[model samples]
Target chain A: MSDSPIVNEFNQGPISCHAFNGDRTELAICFNTNVVTIFRKSGASWTQTSTLVEHDKPVTSIDWAPKSNRIVTCSQDRNAYVWTLDGASHQWKPTLVLLRINRAATFVRWSPEEDKFAVASGSRCISVCYFEEDNDWWVGKHIKKPIRSTVLSIDWHPNNVLLAAGCADMKARVFSAFIKGIDKKPAPSPWGEKLPFNTLCGEFSNGAGGWIHGVAFSPSGESLVFTGHDSTITVVSPGTGDIQSIRAPYLPYLSVIWLNENQIVAAGHDCAPHLFERKGQQWAFSASLDAAVKKADVGFTARDTFRRMDSRAQSTTSTDTEVHTHHQNTINSIRSFSGTPEHVEQFSTSAIDGKLILWNADSISRGLGNLHL
Target chain B: MAFRKIDIDALEEDAFGEDEIDFQEIGELRPVADVDAQVNSRAQEVRSLLQRGNTSGALSTSLQNPPYGAPFHAAKARNTQTVMEVLNSIKVSDVPQLVKSLSPEEQDVLMKYLYAGMAAPEQNNSGHLLAWHEKLTEVAGQGCIVRVITDRRTV
Candidate 1:
C-alpha cells in the first residue's frame, strides 16, 4: 500500500460527487454535469468503462452500495436512478425511482443495510425511497413536516430507520424515515421508541444559526456531528442532551464523516480536510490532514534576483499560482475508501479542482507523531 | 423549449401556502417595555467600575446582559456607548493580558462587543476596537467572531 496520498487528476470538470465500489476498483463520478461516468481502476490510473446518462440535469449526489453492488445517482433534474450491471450485455441498466418532488434532489444516501435510500431535495422535504417488489420499481415516501427550508445533507443511523438531516435553514434535525412494509420495527434508540414515519426525533441549531452544510452519525449512532456555514462543528448526543460546538478557524466545511468512534474528518472551502477528535468528553480540532509543505524559493539566487529585478522591475515572482496543498480547490466530499466504520484505514476526498486524493489514516497518525488514531 | 427561471420565494409560498405566518417574525414580536431602568442602572454600574480603574471588571460588567428584545433603542445606545468607553480606556499593550484573564465564555462575549463597537466607528475609536479585536481573536480563535455573527442576540 502507498503511504503517500494517491492523487488522481481526472481533469474532468469539478467532480461534484463520487463513489467507489466494494473493492475500491471502480469509481462513479459526476463532473458537475448530467451524466455519471464509471472508471475502472488500472494500477495508478483509471480508464472510463461506461457512462450512466439518465438525468437531464446535473447529478448532485451518488452512492454506491457495496454489498448490493447497486449505484444510486440523484440529480437536479429531480430524479434518481439505480444502476445495476447486467450479466448478459456487460452493461449497466438504470431503474428510475419515482421521487415525486418538483424541485432539485440535492443529496442521496443508501442505508447501511442497503434496503432503502433517502433523497434530500430543495422541495423542503426528504423522500425515503424503497424498492417495491410488487410494482417492480422503487417508490418514495415523503417526510415533510417542520422542515422549513431545503434539506442539504442527510445521514442514516446505524439502525437504518432514523435519518439525520442538515438543512439550509441552519437546523440539524433527526426524523424517523421508517417505512411500514420495507422496514422492520427498529430497536429502541436514543432518538425515539416509536417507529412511525416523519417523527421529529430531535431538532437542533448550531448555536449561532448558520446553514448546516454536512451531518454524520457516529460509528455507534449514539452521537451526531454536523458542520455549519458559521465554521462551527456541533456534536449532539440525543440520549444525554449534550451538545458541544467548536468554531473552526478555517472556512466553513461542506462535508464531514466519522473516521471512527472518536475521530471525524471534515473538508470544505478551506481546500483541506481537517481531523476533529473527541478527547475526554469534548470534541476539538485535532490537526489538518493536508500536510502542505511550504514551497521553497527555488532558483532565486542573488544573481537571478538582480537580473529579474532589472528586467521586470519586480523583487519577487508574483505569478506563482499553485496552492501548496494537493487539492487546488474546495474539497466537497469525503468518504471511507477502505476499512470498517470502527477503524477507517484509508479515506478519499474529491475537490472542485477535479482531483480525487486517497489519504492513509494510519500514515497521518504516524506523521502527526502524538496523535494516535 | 425556453425555460423560465422559477421564483423560489413564490415557489415556497405556493408549497407552504400564503396564509402560513413566518415563525421568525412571530419570535421577534414581544410586548415593548416602557422604562429603560435596568439598562440605565447597568450602564451606571459599568461606568463606576471603569472609574475605579477595574478595566476587566468594567469590561465583564458591560458585557453581561446587553439590552435586546425590546424597543429600548435609546437605552441600548447608552449601553453601547458605555461599553465603547470601557474598551477605549484599555491600554493596547495590556490587551493580551486582559484577554488572557477572561474565561472562554467571557472571551466570546468580548468578541461580540468588539464587533458591535466596530460597527459604529465614528462613535468608538476604531484603533482601540481593532486592537481588542486582534487580541480577542488571538485568544478565542476565529470561531468567536463566527459565534458573534451567528448569535441573533446583539449588544
Candidate 2:
C-alpha cells in the first residue's frame, strides 16, 4: 500500500515466526490455524518455500538447531515436533515427535555448541534433550522446580553449557552443565544417569508484583538483562550478584535482544520498539519509533513485505492526515538481522497494520537525506 | 508559702566540715523513687525502638530530646569514660607502627573506609588519623606492618 519495500506477504496469515537457519535466508511462519508456511527471498521477491500442516493446535514456539538442518516446533498440544527440509521434494516433513510431556511447551531454544535443545514446559520445568546421529532425540537432563503461577520463558547460554529460565515466580535461574567422569561422576538415577544440574544462581522476587516475562544474556555472556511486567528493566552482574534496576515509563517489556555488547533493543507493551545503551553505570534510552510509524509498520505489512512497506508508510503519513489518524494493531515481536552497511533487514510484527517494514540503518545513520523528512 | 535561698557553700561546710567535698557523698545522691521508675520506663521504650530496626528514630529521640532524669544518662556517661580511656592509651607516634601489622586484604578494606571516613570512632581511638591507622593494620597482614610504616612515610 505504501512505497516501502515489501519482502513478502502471506495470504494464509502468520501468528508466530522463526528463522530457518543462521543466515535467516528462509523464514518459517506459524498460523493461528494449524498451518506453517516457509518463505524464501530471491532477488527482492519472496516465494512460498513450503507449507506444512501437521499440528492440530496453534504453534506456540519454533527454534532452529545450530548444527543441524532440523526445525523444532512446540504447540498447545503439549508436544515438540522436529521437522527436516527435504531438498528433493522441496517440502518440510516431521521427523521426530516428542510427546507425553504432560504440559504445554511455551518456548524452545537450541544450545550453541551441541545438538542439545531446551524446552520450557507449562509445568515449571526445563527439559534438555539432545539429538543423536541416528536421528533420534533423547532427554538428557531435566531441571524441575515447584509449580509456577504462570508459564515461564527459557533460553540457552550463548556457548551452550548453561541454561537460563525466567519464571512466573519473578526469578531468573541459571543452570550449568556438568560432565560425567571428566568433571564429576554422574549419579545413577531412574531418569537416566545424567548429571544433576542444580540452580547455580537466581535473582529477583516474582512475589514483588513483577513477573519476569523474558530474559536475555549479552552476546559476550558476561551480563544478564531481564524485563518484567513491573515496567522495570534490570541488569544483573552474574559474577558479583549486584542488580541495577531501571524503570521504563511504559511497563511490561515484552521482549529484548542484544544488538551488541553495550546496546539492547526491546519491545515495550506500548507497541513501540526502543533502543537502550548502557551509559556509565546505568541504562538510558537512545531511540524509539513514534506510535504512528510503529502501527503502520506492524499492521498491514506481512513478514517478508516489512522492509519494502516501511518507507511508503512514512511518506504517506506525512502527506495524508487520514492515514495518520488510523488506529492499528500493536506490534507483538521484532527481529533484526546484521546485514551489509547499505541494507538491514527486520521481520514479522503485527501484519494487521502492515508489519513487514524495512529500513536501511546505514543510510538512515548517514543522515535522513533519502527520506522525506 | 515562699521558697528561701540557702547558702549551699555554707551548707556544704556544715554537712561535710571540709573545704573539699567528699566524692563518696556526691555518688550517694539519688533521685526520687517515682522519678527513677519513670526514667527506667522511658529507657525501655528507646531500647524496644532500636530492636525493631528503627535506629534513626531511636538515635534522634535519645540525643535530641532525652527524658528528664533518664536512667540512660549514667550508661552514656560510662560509655564516654571508656572511650576516653581507650583514646588516652594510644600514642600519636605509634600509629605508623600499628598500621604496619595488618594483612593486604585487611589493608584494602580498612583503606576504603579510612579514605571514605567511615571507620568506627570507638575502635580507632576517636582520632581520624588513629582510625585510619587502626583500619590499615587490621587489613594488612601483621607481617607487612613494616611495609605500611615505610609506605606511609613515602606518601
Candidate 3:
C-alpha cells in the first residue's frame, strides 16, 4: 500500500491531453504543441509509434474511440481531425471535421456509441459533428443559443444523445445533442423527455460561483458532478433536483472522473487528486489519494540543515521550492485507465510538469481502509 | 407561383437567436431575508466579544452565515468592517492559537475577510491583517488563499 505510483516522463513538454486505445497498448498524447504523438507500449516503457501533424496550432485535446479504433484530435487552430488506420498503407489517416468555429477548439469527446463526437470551443458554442455519407465528409451542427462563454470541458451521457458542458461563465449545462438520423429517440430519464437537439435539460453552478473546470456523469448517467475553480465539487441529480456542493481544503480541480457510482476523483492546480464519496444523500471529501508524509521523516539530514542555513538565513532544513505531492505542478487532466465505469481499477493523470502518473485503486483502497473505490 | 428555397445556414447567419442571460442563481433564487438586521446584530456581538478578549468567539460570530445575495451589499460591507475591527484587535502573538482554534469552515470565512481587509488598506491595519494571514495560511495551507481569491462570495 505504501508503494509509489507508476511515473513516466515524456520530456517533450507538458501533455495537454491523452487517450488510450481499447487494449491500453497505444496512447495518443498532445505535448502542448501542434503535433499529436502516438506511443506504443513495449514491455514496461512506451515508444513513439507515429506523429499526427495536421493542426497548424497547439493541440488542446485528444480522444480515442476504443471500440472503433479511431482517434479524434482538436486544436487551437479551430479545426478537428479524425484519424483512422489505413490498412493498405499501414499508416494513420486524418479526416477533417468542419467545425466552422471562429475561435479555438478546447475540448473534444466521442459519444458512447462513437457514431458522433462533440467539440467544445472558445467561440461560445459546441459543435456536434457526425459523418455525412452523401458528402463523404463530416459536418457539424452548432449548439449556440445558451452558452455565453468558452466551454472548458465536456462529458457524454451513456445514452449517447446528451452532452454536459462546463463553461467559463461559471455554469454547467446539460443539453440534448440528439441528431435526427444518427441517434434514436432516447428514453425518458431524470434529465428530461421529448429530447430535441440543443434542448437544455438542466443548468447548474457551484453556489460560490467559480468557473466550472470539469464535469462528469455517473456510470448510470443518473447523476452529474462538476468541479469549480472555487475549490468545490458539486453533484446534482436531475431526477430529484438535488444539488450537493462540497468545497475541499485544496486548490481548484481542473479535471474529475467517476471511479464508481458513489466515488469521484478530482485533480488540478493542487497537483494531487482527492477522493469524494457519497453517503446517503450527502457528498463529502473522503481522502486525499496522495497522502501527505512528514518532511522530516526522509531526506532531512544535518548536512542539509547546515547547507540550508548557509545558503539562506533560515535555520530550518525545509525545501521551499519543492512540493511534497507526487506531481510537482498543476495536474491538467485525469482519465480512467482501466476497469468498468462502475469501478475504475486504475486512472492516469497528466500535469504541467511533464509527467504522466498512473494510480492504482487497489493500493489506495488498501491504504485507506473502509474505502470501496 | 414558384417559391424560393430557404437555406437554413443562411437564415441562422442573418437571424438573431434568443440570448440567454447567465445570472447567478444563488443571489436571485434565494429570497432575501432580514440580512441587514442580522448582520448588524452579529457585528455588535462580535465587537463585544473582541472587547472581552474572546477572539475565537468573535471570529466564529463574524463568520457565521455571512450576508449573501445582491440585495444586501450594505450589510455585507458593514459586516466586513466589523470583522476587520475584530481582526485588528487581536494580538500578533495570539494569532497562531486563534487560528488553530477555528474550524476549517471558519478558517475559510476568515480568509475571505483577510482578503477583503487587505483590499481596503485604508480601512483596516495592514500589519494586523498580514499577521493573521500568515497564521491562517500556516494552519489551512495554500488552499485557503485560492478559495478566497476564486470564490465569488465576498465578505
Candidate 2: stretches off by over 4 Å: A1-11, A97-100, A132-135, A177-196, A206-208, A290-327, A339-354, A357-373, B1-155
lDDT of 1 by residue, A1-373 (tens): 8898899999989999999999999999999999999999988899999999989999999999999999999999999999999999989999999999999999999999999999999999999999999999999999988897899999999998999999987789999999887789998988889869999999988766677989999989999999998788999998888999887867789999998888889999878899998878888899988887777767368897887789878788664655778899999999999888878889999999999999998787667674544
For the predicted complex of model 2, DockQ is 0.01
**Candidate that would win on lDDT:** 3
Candidate order by TM-score, highest to lowest? 1, 3, 2
Q: What is the interface RMSD of each candidate, in Å?
A: 3.6, 26.4, 3.6
TM-score for all models, in order of appearance: 0.89, 0.56, 0.87
For candidate 2, what is the TM-score?
Answer: 0.56
> Which portions of model 1 show Cα errors greater than 4 Å?
A299-323, A366-373, B1-35, B68-72, B103-105, B148-151
Give fnat, all candidates.
0.40, 0.00, 0.58
The superposed Cα distance between candidate 3 and the true structure at residue A105, in angstroms, equals 0.2
A236-324, model 3: which lDDT tens digit per residue?
99888899888687889999999988789999998889989878878999888987654664547878778778878677755676688
Note the residue pairs that clash in candidate 1.
none
